[model samples]
Target: MNPVVEQMNRRRSVRNFSGKPVDEVHLGRILLAAQQAPTSINGQQISLVVTRNKETIARIAEIAGGQPQVAGAEVFVTVVIDYHRTREALKSVGAEQVIAQSAEGLMVGATDAGIMLNALQTAAESFGYGTTAIGGIRNDPQAMIELLGLPAETFPLVGTTIGVADDASLAQVKPRVPLATFAHMERYDAEAVRRGVAEYDRQLRLWWDEQGLTQMPSYSESTAQYYSRVYFPKVAESLESQGFEFRDD
Candidate 1:
């Protein structure tokens, strides 16, 4: 088996870290890894702002609803979905007029930003460093944009904090559903999907209970509750307030 494959299988989110710092050499390699990720249309719209400043880290932790692990990480990197670079690239090549008139370019920028983040996470894990992705950073987009000096149309999507893990900070790998549940044959099988979820829900509830967490409701119920209780409304408001016009044809 390939070393990278093994690493991929073992990857888990780490929200705790040691006092030790990540060396600059490894940090540069991680940036390189992000740059190497495949981008939509080669748009390469991701931008990263690295911060080692304690004050800035503190602010990010606060903005992320006070995730203490974030404040103590050795380095923080804010990943942004950026349109400024794309806009400038188009202008330099005399394509600005056409590109600016279409939202296609903007969509590509956002997709590439997501690709870059996954690359960064993989790179950090491969190098034996711990990382925690801070999605709540999006909750205070306006403040983060100002703090990071982001130009209009450029926005912080999320951030990742990285450091070596302390002995006591090691985390267990959480179990996911068996491949048979999601890896299906050629055509979609609705019944199989439904049955799979039933089995997985049992597995999940058992795991959660063992970990001293509350039992899950039925899979569909839990799925609906997650979005209704935590996701969609906030996301919709964020996009609208950030000036992203929703267009339905």
Candidate 2:
């Protein structure tokens, strides 16, 4: 395998850190790597707020359900999807057609944020640093926005934490679903994909068993029921309360 591909495969999210402060020069490089990530139509709507202050970090971690990973991070970076830029651009150019100022526009910002985050993760791993992405930052949107002092038309898309590795605990790679399960050729192949997923589930279960993780759960069964019970309603209510309007595409 190519070295870069190997590096990527070996990358894992680190929840524990050594609490070593990253110097401004290295932090600048990581930020620059993120800035260079690809964006939709060259319209980059991702905004990042870097927090090194103990108070802000504490507040963000509190809003993230008191995840120790967030508070323990040497640096906490909140990545937001910004819609105001698109609105300003549309008005500036006098475009008659405007994208809906809701989830549709928000998707663009989130996509940009995701791409940039992946780049930062890759760069950090290459530099021998440990990093973790915190999607839980979206759990309480209003609190996060208020704590970060975010402006209107902006939503917390995700967050990232960085610090020095303690002892390479996160050096191993997590298994992924088989390509046949998600990757398609010229057209969709549902049956083939289903079979691939079954194989993947078996592999995952075996891996879990070997790792002595608690009783292995069916991948599809848990995933299908997870949203209805845990994520969707909370996320929906939070977004609605924060004045985010979503329109059908």
Candidate 3:
């Protein structure tokens, strides 16, 4: 396999860091990689805020559902989906309105943020750094917005913590669903998806058993329960309160 593919395959979330600091030059390169990530129609809708202040990191950790890694990592990068900058640009160019509050605009911004985050992660990994993405940043979107001093038309999408990982913190790579499960040729295949998920569940269960985690539920069941009971309700309310308009009409 190609070296890049091998490196990517080795990537896993690292929650326990060694607490050693990352060199500034390497951090600069990682940020540069994020800056070069592709965006929709050249609209750079993502902004990154690097927080190295210990006190601020601790506060962020509290806001992020008490993820200690946020405070203990060498650095925390908050990836924000920002239409505020674009809105200002439009105003400067004499455009009458900014349409960043709509669903389409939100999707574009979020996509840009995700792409940049991937770049950041890959770059950090290539530079011999361990990183983990923190989605808990959205657990309290309003608080995150106020804490980060984010302006209107900007939202925190995700966060990444960069540091050297402890030997014990390199978790085993978890199994992923087969490509056939999601990749289709021209049309969707419901049967393939069903079979694929069933196979994946079996594989996951085996892996969990080997790791002494037999209580873990199947991927499909867990995801369905989470979205239906926990994720959607909270996220929808948070997004709406942050000026995002979702229209399904």
Predicted structure with the largest lDDT when compared to the true one: 3
User: What does candidate 3's lDDT look like per residue over 1-249, in tens digits?
Assistant: 998899999988888888788999999988987798898988787899999888888988998889887878889999998877777778898984345656788778778888888999999999999999998888888888888898877788899999988877577998888888778989999999989999999998888898888899988878887777665236666666666775532
Error of 1 at 84 (Å): 0.3
- The Cα RMSD of model 2 versus the native structure comes to 2.7
Give the poorly placed runs of model 1, Cα more than 4 Å off: 97-106, 212-225, 230-243
After TM-score superposition, what is the CA distance of residue 197 in candidate 3 from its true location, in Å?
A: 1.3
Local distance difference test values of all predictions, in order: 0.76, 0.76, 0.84
Give RMSD to native, each candidate. 2.8, 2.7, 2.0
Candidate 2 clashing pairs? none
Ranking by lDDT: 3, 2, 1
Candidate 3, number of clashes = 0
Give the candidates in order of TM-score, highest first: 3, 2, 1
Model 2 global lDDT (CA atoms, 0 to 1): 0.76
The alpha-carbon deviation from the true structure for residue 107 of candidate 1, after best TM-score superposition, in angstroms, is 4.0
lDDT of 2 by residue, 34-77 (tens): 78888888877777899999888888888888898888888888
Expressed as tens digits, the lDDT of each residue in 128-193 for candidate 1 is 998877887877777777788888556788888888987685656766766765787787777877
For candidate 1, the TM-score is 0.86
Task: Give the TM-score (vs. native) of candidate 2.
Answer: 0.86
